[model samples]
Target: MVCVEEYAVRVLVTGGAGYIGSHVVRSLQGSGHTVAVLDDFSTGSRRRVGADVPVEDGSLLDTAFVEASLRRLSADAVVHIAAKKAVEESVADPLFYYRENVAGMQSVLEAMVSAGTRRLLFSSSAAVYGASATSPVTETSPTDPSSPYGWTKLMCEQMIRDVSLAHGLSWSALRYFNVAGAADPTLADRGESNLIPKVFRAISSGVRPQIYGDTYPTPDGSCLRDYIHVNDVADAHATVLEHMENADLCTVYNIGTGTGTSVFDVMTAVRLVTGVDFECDICPPRPGDPADVVADPAKIRAELGWASQYDLGSAVESAWKAWSDAPS
Candidate 1:
């Protein structure tokens, strides 16, 4: 196995200017690894990236551009974090999700092949496990994606596996649960569809937030999710990269807190953090919705020696602080 400790490692992050991607970039740099960025700036702001980092501004669908950037940087590893992640939006437009998430990943893989970069750390989701009956879904759980977004992530993982088998690529797909909070106020999640942002947006507009469903099988009769902190998610990328470089194997690990928090529970947390007793409307459940989706993080904790540091309240507190500070 090739070790990155023997020499300096340069990692190219595909969506380095985006929310999670930006934090991952900072984490990699802090770990003494040289980092560069490749993003089109469509959804990500250039301000999120450090001015010193060389950024290749282009779409991942453009294989030539990605390959050129990879070759230019001679990156030792590629952290593919670029993708459209809204589940509802994906169900509404499956074709767009396929093109952006699936096809875009293919372009990244093709570019890696051309550039002779063999290491990859994929940004995956628990959505790939769909509506499993398991309380805390394990890495070995049967994958049955419930949405187009989930399907795209599963397909990307499969592609990485195939590429590894055929081309000697070492990879790790960190299947993340609900990612929340911000390392910095400027890095706060600006996503309209994400739950925390949605709640903040509704409160800011003096409107009650909508709770999609209240008839699920869970204790709270709402969707249960493992909301992991973004900083911890960022640290997972760095740790997993180091693991892949030293071990040189293809593997999958769930990146989340083993605990689960329901949608209603999240609203309560928001109220406590923001000191606003906001009401919510229990509306019909959206399509492609799952009841419970938490992570069985034993694999990562035992293998990589990494664990989540923030609890649900801390996630809400940090997220509210950043959300409150963002410009209207």
Candidate 2:
């Protein structure tokens, strides 16, 4: 077992102004750690982070800027969360995905080496498992990503492992499932990318939400997914950081609730939360989408003592509250 250390440390969070990144910043700060943010704000918003947190506005592709920021902050660890994450967009433009997600990760690794920052907590994805994964996916599950986005995440995880072997960088890659909801209205997700927010956007525009597939082999015939709260995912990042020791440690864990909720169930939850009896359109199954992609969180629970505190209903409620309050 890797040794655990107890002390407050300064941490730099890349993409800290984004949805998940913002929550992570708050979680780390709540744990009494000094926190700073590094974001280009391409998809992130400055309003998500507090004024107390120092922001280093720049691109991670620029290794010099990232290195300078780490040196200036004297960071004890780095939480790398900056990456393009739209699966469809990645499929449309594989080159952009490789450059941004893959090359950008390399740049951060290089800057970490140059700046002498040893500790890292990477924001990986469950996409690495891709379609055909069994329900309740584990860390040891075979990685056969179906899309360019998942490929980039897998490549980045490998890079982190290789860097750890040579540079003695203590690291943990958290493969989180579908993250929904916000810590509060101010920190709400501003994008219309994922399922919950996409549905909210559709409803807000007076259009019925679209269910991609409804004839899967699930209990409800709709696809099942593990939707963990953004706050819980943020908390997992803090827990991994707190438990990391000063040794050359490389670890990976699945961050999720270990439960699957069908798409119809999510729509039902949305109606209950928003009190809107809006109907949904059933569409053909999306290519590469699995019938079920829930996480098997036993590893993180037993190893790091981390588990989700929010359920599907909680996620839908908070997401609706935030989306309803977001400005036009």
Best by TM-score: 1
TM-scores, one per candidate: 0.97, 0.96
State the displacement of the C-alpha of residue 203, model 1, in Å, after optimal TM-score superposition.
0.5
Q: Pick the candidate with the highest lDDT.
A: 1
lDDT of 1 at 272: 90
User: Tens digits of per-residue lDDT for model 2 on 118-226?
Assistant: 9999999999998878878999998888889999999999999999999889999999899999878878886766899888888888999999888888998998899
Candidate 1 versus truth, CA RMSD in Å, comes to: 2.0
TM-score of 1: 0.97
Give the C-alpha miss distance for residue 296 in model 1, angstroms: 0.4
Model 2 stretches astray by more than 4 angstroms: 1-6, 245-248
lDDT of 1 by residue, 1-328 (tens): 2234653488999999999999999988888889999999989988789988999999999999999999999988999999999999999999999999999999999999989999999999999998764768999999999999999999999999998899999999999999999987878898878899899989988999999999999998999999999999999988887777568868999999999999999999999999999889999998888999899999989998989999999888888898888654
Full-model lDDT, candidate 1 = 0.91
Candidate lDDT (C-alpha), each: 0.91, 0.89
Per-candidate clashes, comma-separated: 0, 0
